[model samples]
Target: MKSTTSALLNRIEFPVLLAGLLIAAGLWGFVELMELARAATPHAFDTEILLAFRHAGQPDNPIGPLWLQGAMRDITSLGSTSVLVLVTTATIIYLLLIRRPAAALLMFVAVAGGKVLSILLKFEVDRPRPELVSHLVNETSLSFPSGHAMLSAITYLTLGSLAARFLPDRTTRIFVLGLAVLTTVLVGISRVYLGVHWPSDVLAGWCAGFAWAMLCWLAARLLQRRKVLADSE
Candidate 1:
């Protein structure tokens, strides 16, 4: 087991390690900020920001609980276990189509791991949903680290990174990455607009999600490199 671990670590490129470290640092700082905000004036700036976002794209005259309820349903639906399961199944099919079982397995691990971690964090923090504003959507969950935001980040980013590998040019790769980021960002924003999460909650979710995605990406790259080296030998 020790030898296996050693060989695996050896395959991780130095640059990947550096990038991971940087990402980890940023995420750690963000986590600290969230904790501070939660502890001291949890209803101050973060709450205000979230409320502003909630009203930004909302229907005029406030549609009462209907739209809000629907938005809540949509966000909650996005986090359903079935979505994760279906995504994993789709990824497997895609991997089979592309003949890359190893990468597919890596993606499955990333997404599954992200889902488990998201649940754990939700329980650990147990942050309450915002009660300050009329919810555009009704939801009942621990609000710290929005589940939809984090899951979307991990799943979409993982798939996006994998997709980038298949693109033939830098422009195409950038476009794919941009789309992934946009989707993730929009999902996070939607949580706030729907009044289901605090700004800090969404921010922490983004950090955690991005950190997990990057870590998994590094792992996948390391695995792929070792496989290539083994084939050469």
Candidate 2:
């Protein structure tokens, strides 16, 4: 019995350990990107990309409607606070209703904590918004780590993971994850298109977002294992 329990603990701990290592790696990668973005002087490539991204907000682009523009703008304005509070409340209610306190708590922390980490990274990097082109939409934050990209990744991926719980097949699970990733990518692109962020900024956001999502998934997996062990006892 002791050996079996030890093995279970090892299995359960693996994901958390992996996540911690990944988070550390992500932090290093984000720092490296920041250094590169900062050290490189603005070039023609930056100028061209900035122009193109800002152009996306123009009336001529059929891909983006006025309403969608308005929505993205609104979401960007919420900063990190909106998602944190919303996810927290929702997770609490969900846990209470479903009687899965561990899972709920883990989800809440993963989402909420991701938001907080995003903010800290933003301040730490302090990369200015692009000056090569004028912004079509309103934006007033540091541009290195795109907030919309980060939040969309966290929120969508979290929800997708939860959704996958009900899905039995591997294909369905992959589909859910793909959808979450696609949404995150679209949101990041929209930021660039609206001239609110640079392509490099979006790239950094993607890296950071991916890293954070992996960490959150790791936490959730660990929580699930704990629940499984509890049930066994």
Candidate 3:
């Protein structure tokens, strides 16, 4: 039995196994957050996290210094639609220029599809933006799941995974992926700090975004293995 189990594990590619686990965990987490989002009473978890960003006595004042607030705004912009689109376009162009049209097309579809999915989710949930605290930036969209958080995860993770394929060193690939996750997490946190979204919204965004990105990665992997997509640059 032990040998059989070991052989079964060895038969699965490590990357595929990791991606499968992430997808399953993400889907489970998203469902849990959905329940929270639909509840009439706001969950205590959301309120506590939302208030943590504010100053002790002043709800209007964020916890960080003035410069920190400015820095956060800049960090948050990394997840904005304009910035992400520009990055995706530039990346696709670079990939094409390097004679990797297949990789470039994959990049385009992954990010673009993620955008459509985010929009669909926003309408499906029809949850309103948080009014518990003042919004630091202007926003007038349904907010059961944060668009910024989700898109940032999708964009950064997809880009990072693609970049990893071209890198030769194992450590370098891990670093690239870690940076992608870090950027995604920071963007999600910034949305809550800005008071534009509840904590649950960001959680749901992360869950959905991660699952979608992994699925895309897995699909691309399968295609490459089948000679339908480019194996490398």
Candidate 4:
């Protein structure tokens, strides 16, 4: 039993272990948020957090300066469908040009899968946008999970992880990954600040997005190990 346990532990690398943990945590959090989203009433924390972004008794006016609101609009655009599609297309083209068809294919699958998953979850919960505050930007989609937040996490993190593989050193890889995470986080926060999503919606988006990205990474890793997908040259 001791020897078998030791062998099992030895077979699990840090990356695999970390990805497994993240998948578990993300799925758990997403499920909890989904339950809250299905409730007839908004969760207390969701309303409280959404309200915190707006001026007291003035849901129409956000708490920040006018310029800050503009800045948030710009930041939030980084997670928009248009921007994400452009970035993903450009990355895929670059990968293809560099003779990394395997990586390009994986990238497409990861982002496209995330997009579909986001849409399904949105419809599944069928939650409406927060009416507690005025939306700084108009959004017509169902709002259980913010598409911007989920897609941003998927695209940026996938791109970041792929970039890290080719980076020369650990520090550079860490920096790229950190930037991806920061961007994802900022996008999620912007959703709440703009009054387009409840805090739980953004949180759920992040959870689902992170899990999907990590699942793709694991799939790619497995394919590479099996020689089904070529590693970066």
Candidate 4 lDDT over residue span 1-233, tens digit each: 99999999999999999999999999999999999999999889999999899889888999978999999999999999999999999999999999999999989999999999999988888999999899999999999888998999999999999999899999999999999999999999999999999999999999999999999999999999999999565
Q: What is the descending TM-score order? A: 4, 3, 1, 2
Winning model by lDDT: 4
RMSD of 2: 5.8
TM-score of candidate 3 versus the correct structure, residues matched by position: 0.94
- Give the TM-score of each candidate: 0.78, 0.72, 0.94, 0.98
lDDT order of candidates, top first: 4, 3, 1, 2
| Candidate 2 error regions (>4 Å) | 1-29, 43-45, 54-88, 223-233
Candidate 4: 10-residue stretch with minimal lDDT: 224-233
In candidate 3, what are the lDDT values of residues 1-233, reduced to their tens digit? 99999999999998899999999999999989989999988899998899899977677889978988888899899999999999999999999999888878878888899899999989988889888888898999899789899999999999999899899999999999999999999999999999999999999999999999999989988888898988456
- How big is the positional error of residue 113 in model 3, measured in Å on the Cα after superposition? 0.7
* Better model by lDDT: candidate 3 vs candidate 4: 4
lDDT scores in order = 0.75, 0.69, 0.91, 0.94
Give the clashing pairs for model 3: none
Top candidate on TM-score is 4
Writing each residue's lDDT as its tens digit, candidate 2 over 1-233 gives 99999888777666466667767886687776777667667545555776664345543352446787677665554334565467657766876576766556656766777778778878987878876655657678788788777777777777777667769998999999899878777777777766767777777777787688777677566556676412112
Steric clashes per prediction: 2, 0, 0, 0
Comparing 1 and 4 by TM-score, which wins? Answer: 4
Off by over 4 Å in 1: 1-18, 40-43, 54-84, 228-233
Writing each residue's lDDT as its tens digit, candidate 1 over 1-233 gives 99999998998778587758857875895678567545845757676676565445643323346666566556555555577678778987988676777777778888889989988988887778876666655577788788888888888888888888788999999999899888778778777766677877877888888888888877667666677412112
Worst 10 residues of 1 by lDDT: 54-63
